[model samples]
Target chain A: NAGVTQTPKFRVLKTGQSMTLLCAQDMNHEYMYWYRQDPGMGLRLIHYSVGEGTTAKGEVPDGYNVSRLKKQNFLLGLESAAPSQTSVYFCASRTPRTSGKNTGELFFGEGSRLTVL
Target chain B: EDQVTQSPEALRLQEGESSSLNCSYTVSGLRGLFWYRQDPGKGPEFLFTLYSAGEEKEKERLKATLTKKESFLHITAPKPEDSATYLCAVITSSTLGRLYFGRGTQLTVWP
Candidate 1:
């Protein structure tokens, strides 16, 4: 089973360009998140969705937007890419904590490498 | 603000050498502490989770122990394949269960 998959594994964009990264998960998790990884900054959250049709800004949401229109897909958009946005992006999803199970672990996608010039 | 910090930004050890990586955090109402291993050009993989202080979990040669303020990932008799970046993250009561990650510790086990 494909747990989590990301599209456009690698991409390059000039400054002021726009693009979207797609993340699809088969786990049917209720929580999905977008994160960016840089050399020393580690992985910083960009945006997240607790359920379909819901989204919330994260620590580094300045130049990014996100949508979770479907239960299985979460899209991250760069409205106007900039050099500072060059970083590897990762998508993760997790099951909710319920009376039957109280776990907080995330399953991640392979990651998308984006470079803005 | 919640914060997670990992120490010894990088480490190199000979095969069979035992060592430990540290992760410290400052947050209120912590829900859980997690450890993840990430290979180059790949995403972070879940390793272990600690729910409360004084809890410990072991897998193969790796062991994770948690305290009120910090956690430790201990590698016993390491192998070259154990080389990777180890990340520490935490979930707090106020985050809506969202995770906050640390800078990570890069470990290299030489043969």
Candidate 2:
């Protein structure tokens, strides 16, 4: 089974443009997350969802919006992309049973690279 | 505020040489500590999880140990295939499942 899949493996967008990144998981996990990795900055959380129809803000959520309308999908939207928003984005998910036990081992997507010019 | 830090931004070792990476964190209440290895242009891969201080976990050539304020990832007899960035993250008890990640330690092993 495909554990996690992210759409648009690579993208180049002009400043002020809008785009959406899609993440789908086949594990039926209750928790999903969005993170951005920047050079020397590591991975920073953008937004997360505990389950379908729920979303929460993360460390860096100012320029991003998230929707978890279906249990298998989580989408990240950039209203007006900026150069600072250019980075490799990763999506992750974990089953509730493991997550409740505090074992934070996550199943991650390959990643989506976005470049804003 | 919760914070995680890793040391020696990068490391290089010979095929048979061994080394260790450090991850330090400060959080309100600890739930678990995780270790992941990431290759260039790929997502992080799960390695180990330490639930409390004084706990240790081992896998093949890697061993992870956790403490009250820090954790260590020890690699035994490295190989070129083991070269990658190692990341450490902390999951707090209060948060549902959010993880705070460190900058990560990049390692390269030459054959």
DockQ of each: 0.74, 0.85
Residue A19: error of model 2 in Å? 0.8
Model 1, span A1-117: residue lDDT tens: 999999999999999999999999999899999999999999999999999999998899998989999999999999999999999999999986855444568999999999999
In lDDT terms, how accurate is model 2?
0.93
Q: Compute each candidate's TM-score over C-alphas.
A: 0.98, 0.97
Q: Which CAPRI quality tier does the interface of model 1 achieve?
A: medium
TM-score of chain B of each: 0.98, 0.95
- Tell me how many residue pairs clash in candidate 2: 0
Residue B6 of candidate 1: its Cα lDDT? 99
Error of 1 at A117 (Å): 0.9
For residues B1-111, write the lDDT of model 2, one tens digit per residue: 788999989999999898899999888888888999999989999999898899999999999999999999999999999999999998886775698899999999999
Instruction: Judging by lDDT against the true structure, name the best candidate.
Output: 1
